[model samples]
Target: MPEVVFSVDQSKSMRDQAVPGHNRWHPDIPVAAMVRPGDEFRIECREWTDAQLGNNDSANDVRDVDLTHAHML
Candidate 1:
């Protein structure tokens, strides 16, 4: 599982605050910190396309979204 070692940006300007469901990314599950230089972990990701974004969604929708976070084992 991923662990927090360094730190995360919780500042008002650094936050990714957006509405859920309407957007694929945003209104994120907040986390603080990072992993070390040598850490036991793997990053799993997914790809969301136009089918997921719909016609009204814009590029800016995911621009401020932060996908980095720690996962529990």
Candidate 2:
């Protein structure tokens, strides 16, 4: 398996990761990892909504999710 450069825990929010990710990208953000050409690496990520929507028949989570924090990263 490729080395996990940036790891994420699906059970938790992106902001709760070891190296938390931001909701939006910016050039000022520090590089999370570096790799040379041909290098293979893995980056685990959570859902764009940070799992705000759960695995259930009810759409309450989706309907009530805060749009202000739509994307996790």
Candidate 3:
């Protein structure tokens, strides 16, 4: 198994990450990781909605989720 270069804690927000990731892409956004070509590595990420949607059979979370800071990268 490849070593994990980046990891995410589903229980927390992107900003709370040890090396916080960004939702948007920009040159100003610091590089989260760097690897040599052909390097096998892993990056664990949370849901795009940051788990705004629930696991149960309910669509309310989807309907009411505030996507103001979503699509976590």
Candidate 3 residue-pair clash tally: 0
Question: Which 10 successive residues of model 3 have the least lDDT summed?
Answer: 13-22
lDDT against the true structure, each candidate: 0.34, 0.82, 0.87
Which has the higher lDDT value, candidate number 1 or candidate number 3?
3
In the range 1-73, model 3's lDDT, one tens digit per residue, is 9999988887888888888868888999889889999999999998888778889888898898888978989
Which candidate has the top score in lDDT? 3
Over the stretch 1-73, how does candidate 1's per-residue lDDT look in tens digits? 5643433232212223221112223445444334667777543222332122334577764664444421211
Stronger candidate by lDDT (2 vs 3): 3
Instruction: Spell out the clash pairs found in candidate 2.
Output: none
Point out where model 2 deviates above 4 Å.
none
By summed lDDT, the worst window of 10 consecutive residues in model 1 runs over: 12-21
Error of 1 at 49 (Å): 2.7
Give the winner by TM-score: 2 or 3.
3
State the lDDT at 25 in candidate 3. Answer: 84
**Candidate 2 has what TM-score?**
0.83
